[model samples]
Target chain A: MSTSSTPPAPPPSNRISGTAISKEIRAELAVECSSIKSTVTPGLAVILVGSRPDSLAYVRMKKKACAEVGIDSFGYDYPETVTQQELIDKVNELNADPKVHGILVQLPLPNHIVENLVTSAVHPDKDVDGLHPLNCAKLVTAQTHGGSVKMNWKDLKSIPFHIACTPQGCIELLDRSGVEIEGKRAVVIGRSNLVGMPVSLLLNHRNATITIVHSRTIDAQSVVRTADIVIAAVGRAKMVKSDWLKEGAVVIDVGINSVDAPDTKKGYRLVGDVDFDECEGKCEKITPVPGGVGPMTIAMLLRNTVNSAKRVCGI
Target chain B: MSTSSTPPAPPPSNRISGTAISKEIRAELAVECSSIKSTVTPGLAVILVGSRPDSLAYVRMKKKACAEVGIDSFGYDYPETVTQQELIDKVNELNADPKVHGILVQLPLPNHIVENLVTSAVHPDKDVDGLHPLNCAKLVTAQTHGGSVKMNWKDLKSIPFHIACTPQGCIELLDRSGVEIEGKRAVVIGRSNLVGMPVSLLLNHRNATITIVHSRTIDAQSVVRTADIVIAAVGRAKMVKSDWLKEGAVVIDVGINSVDAPDTKKGYRLVGDVDFDECEGKCEKITPVPGGVGPMTIAMLLRNTVNSAKRVCGI
Candidate 1:
């Protein structure tokens, strides 16, 4: 057989793209933003304590996301030497600002500053990150009481408050991708507060049979192989191998890890916990790295900000 | 002739008695309570908004428990028609009173009043029931961050805050009975905020491979049969038969359902979710209803009250 006779394989394109879905969500939020009856615009205040490259980039991206949705974005950048009290004062100021409906303090704060003290200073109503203790408590309460687990942005009246952005983003991506979450066997790999734990609760709220697989979980591979939906957020690069997944399972990769790539200009490339190439032809749906959960996070942030503003306006 | 030869089965006395275990815990708490350096006594203030017989009985038991430990107990009884503000005001009054170190609001408040509002009004440190939003958030945070999962009342510094009484009691009962929880295959039935959800989280925190089986779970019996430790909190009478349990599995029955008993004074007798009669000689350990988790809740409440008083007095 001649080498040229073999047809070139088609591009690997059967997957959920967070960038495209996030754009759709942003467009929807923009419409809601313009329709607000209140004279005050939906505003987000971003506080960046240190000038770390990744942190600055994230803040800039969040501000741009705010602008795209017709929101008024405010930025505050503090030096690495900023004291804890100074940061908390800024948060209190933002809390009192009527125009600023949401306040977000970027993570990985400097060593001298206590992150919890600063995060808790933001008023729950103005907390867009949804990392506030009160917000976390509300989620626990809602989940325990069998409250609204469905993500219906149109029906904000039922939800207690802003949900954690990353988990909310994961759900938005899954729902918008047309995945049926209810009554499905869903497995979440990892149990971090940031992604794994809250996402499992959200899935359970939507009536899915949830099993959380963490580091100490025995027979993790076998447990994951039974899931109709698999969420990987363990933060290890390509940890969830192809063989670990069930056939035709809907996969949502929430990990963003950097691996060595000598050919790239930065000498590093991003990859999800799942080996994307390995999952190419097996899963019914999967999310790609860099453009998957990353984009959806900011979109949810904007949506939460708009929701906060709407609540303030009583609209 | 066969029944006579069997010698009547030696009376199933191997099971853990919550009443006996709770008595031990109360004894330990009493010793700690009497050694307090503060001049004021540890006090618990319970607010009962209605005349529900169950609620009244629960409150009366709590006061009696407090008195047994040389602690002060206060009660606030209000009509069901009391407004939300009135209840909240009473909570605030108790919160400010130095004499009252813990405040508990009876559950199933009048339908007219929002329960969350009244629950949140109780100060977090003084929330003896551990149902306040702050305390619930702390539990979620601890579980997510790998905090202390073991119940070590003697070493209070390790615990971030008080755990939910029933869940804490479950762990205490197991620990006191010498059932090792670490690295075990644990199955939790039900997903309520009170018992099931928190118990699963607690078990997970202690390095157990946790599987939460709820109403939406499929093949629940098969799933449960794999557990080395089974916690049944589904509130269904005799739902977990012997067939559903693995041989030698340790069982913690949190359910307190009243099934028909025509010969009894109340026309009913309490039973756990587990069919205890069927598991007489099979399981390694089990908890019986009416003398199991029921007594431990009040013991935990007393412990929490003393801890709160210690915190208030900076002991």
Candidate 2:
């Protein structure tokens, strides 16, 4: 048989390393934190109720990060049976405390506590989690001025309000990775308030033509395939397939799901909403699970705290 | 001449009559107002910051509507040179007045006045305009539960918070006219705080897949053509053409612009962002400008006032 010339293999996808970028951001924040120490130390008060193992691990990671960045961390642990009024009272105390620049109440609180009421009780100034209704409203309102204002993400202190950490991290991933956001067709798969909705608003603020597809969207694949940038935050394991993405599209996968992996030590592995192995080659740029948006989220929380401290100290 | 077979003409497009719908809602509100009067009469404080002709006309129209619906209208007119503090103090006074159930500050306040400070001064319970940060936050938070909370537009009293009137009117236009929103592709053109952004959120809350395209959006026409529903809120006159719309798409034109019309006695005529003559037959349904979203805005304001009264009177 005569040998035929084979086509050249496609170039490897550009994998965005959220860990490396997060390290860079933390280094910069460390410098800022040191500089601000002359005036006032940035302090973050983290309140965790009903210590689930995962949440406890997350809080430990956050506190460790705070230490590395030279920020003071205050941990307040509550039992599962703690009353809602007690949590609100603690939040009010933190709001009045001059030392506390940011307050974060861990999510998935005990069922007995009303999440919205507890979250709303945080004063807007110290709402580093950016889950407060006032901060959320600011996020919604900030981008509606017909592209008149451009956000310089590097100047965190300039922003008048805090943005949700995960969503902000998603943007930071794109911004730091040199992905062009303005005027691109961006599809966000999911509509959860914590990530999907706020991220869509942030992308819109950056001048992306945003389409938000959710559980009710018919032919979600077809809708996603039209995007130049795809953000998968649906929290389903490998729910997004290769065919759902447009070739050469930039993807930021915000979902972290545990899937059965019998061969792994814990009998499971963490996967994102996107099928990374299948999608990596097809995407022009893609964020990997665990090393992707997760790291940036903590980095943003530190940045928000530092900025809040600066604002409070009139730096 | 030889006989030739020709295709029959297409069915006529449905022209949604917002004026008629507004009249129907006003009548319903009148009934609600009379019933609420048994406990407490609904009172709206309309604050007009200046004597701009359009602002004056709008204030007059709102007062007339309030009177027709059996609600007391308290008109507060300010000179152009009024201080921001004065306006805010006035707002504070109205906020504390038990007789006032709703406070509406007419938009485009004098340039000297700080609009946000004055608007935020109105207590959230009395912010019928829904511009206050708290109310705006409620609108964003209310929709984030991943389609779990379905908004029944008819049950105004159950919403717990105010939604901006024009955006609310856009949804009412769709709901009243029997346009199915769920699982449909909806494109909203514009990103103004008052209209485009809020309307997109409202549509998202209704489970419609939403795309928001604005000035910075590239290939906006192509993006819009994929939508089953189009909301034209950009202030430009006659910018959306028939070719930009999907076949059988329902369009809600929320724009009211004054364009030069030499033949008219006033040498000007009100038109919408969509080209009415070109798009009317092409659309499955379309709302006319002056008689469409404009009238519905006033109607929703009245509804918000009545709802606030109901909540306050605990009826």
Task: Provide chain B TM-scores across all predictions.
Answer: 0.91, 0.93
Q: Show the lowest summed lDDT stretch of 10 residues, model 2 chain B.
A: B143-152
Q: Please give the lDDT score at residue B120 for candidate 2.
A: 80
Give the TM-scores of the predictions, in the order they appear: 0.92, 0.94
Q: Which candidate tops DockQ?
A: 2
Looking at model 1, residue A186 earns an lDDT score of: 89
True contacts kept of each: 0.45, 0.68
Predicted structure with the largest TM-score when compared to the true one: 2
Which regions of candidate 2 deviate over 4 angstroms?
A1-13, A143-157, B1-13, B143-157
> On residues A71-130, what C-alpha lDDT tens digit does candidate 2 reach at each position?
999999999999999999999999999999999999888877778788888998899999
Give the top-scoring candidate (lDDT): 2
lDDT of each: 0.84, 0.89
| Candidate 1 segments whose C-alpha is farther than 4 A from its true place | A1-13, A143-158, B1-14, B143-158
Per-prediction RMSD in angstroms?
Answer: 4.1, 4.4
Backbone clashes for every candidate come to 0, 0
